[model samples]
Target: MKRCGVGSKNQAKLQAVASVFAEVDYDVQGFDVDSTVSAQPFSDEETKAGAISRAKAVLEKDVEIGIGLEGGVMQMNDGLYLCNWGAIADKQNHVFTAAGAKILLPEEIANGLHRGEELKTVMDLYTNRHGVSHEEGAVGIFTNGVISRADMFIHTVRLLYGQRCFYLS
Candidate 1:
């Protein structure tokens, strides 16, 4: 099986990729790598950059494919929304990127993020739970369990996978 490396050791991200790749023939593993961006990305561009950075950084582990996922809050005219991005990279320097759905965060959560707090921390404190990022995530919490963090990333990964397969083929 071809080796696939993921940029983050986060369980949510690993599971998202593994669940998808399980349908294929790739061996997926997670690695602790730097995103090379601020812990809290405030814009879609920054979030996308973080994903691409992680995807490329994890490729150095000698895997045939590398994947990266990032979660952040973005400010739009309506309000601050939770945003997720995913990227796939190959040894040939080909990169595929796709963004997940954006959900408008509660005013309190947006306020916290605007005040220089990370989404993980803000969500945990807002929900009075620890490790919210690893668990249901802001999407799950906001949607009242209708969607999960992994589910959102899984869709993004699927988009990346499809694009990669199409172009590489």
Candidate 2:
């Protein structure tokens, strides 16, 4: 069995990546490292640099595969938007990255975040609640158990798997 290292401690992200590669017969390993490169990557070079940082961190372990996911908000002509980007690297030092998915931010939330307020704090203030998870029932779901961030993350993992050159055919 091949070993793949994921550059995050977040269980959800790890599980999502594992589930995607399970079909290809690879064992997934999760590791904690400084995946943060920059909160704002406006250009392609900056974005790829961030992903490279993450990929290199995991590659240091000499694993067959390394994966990283970075999520943040980027400013656009319209407003701030959420972007989720990922990268996969092999022991040969080859790397591939998924194109970012952008989600438009509500003006109020964007302004709050710009003012140094954390996203969760802004969500709490607006929703008049505390500690709402981004999971199934918290904010990700739309209908009753109909949607989830996990689902989104899973889709991301699948996309990455499809693009990953190291995956078994």
Q: In each prediction, how many residue pairs overlap at the backbone (N, C-alpha, C within less than 3 A)?
A: 0, 0
Off by over 4 Å in 1: none
lDDT of 1 by residue, 1-169 (tens): 8899999988889889999997898899999999988999988999999999999999999799999999877889999988989999988999999999999998998888889999999888888889988878999998999999989999999999999989989
- Candidates in order: C-alpha RMSD to true structure: 0.8, 3.6
> lDDT values of the candidates?
0.91, 0.67
lDDT for each residue of candidate 2 in 30-76, tens digit (9 for 90 to 100): 88777656554544455556655776689887578888776556688
Ten consecutive residues with minimal summed lDDT in candidate 2? 133-142
Tell me each candidate's TM-score. Answer: 0.98, 0.76
lDDT of 2 at 117: 67
Q: In model 1, how large is the Cα lDDT of residue 34?
A: 94
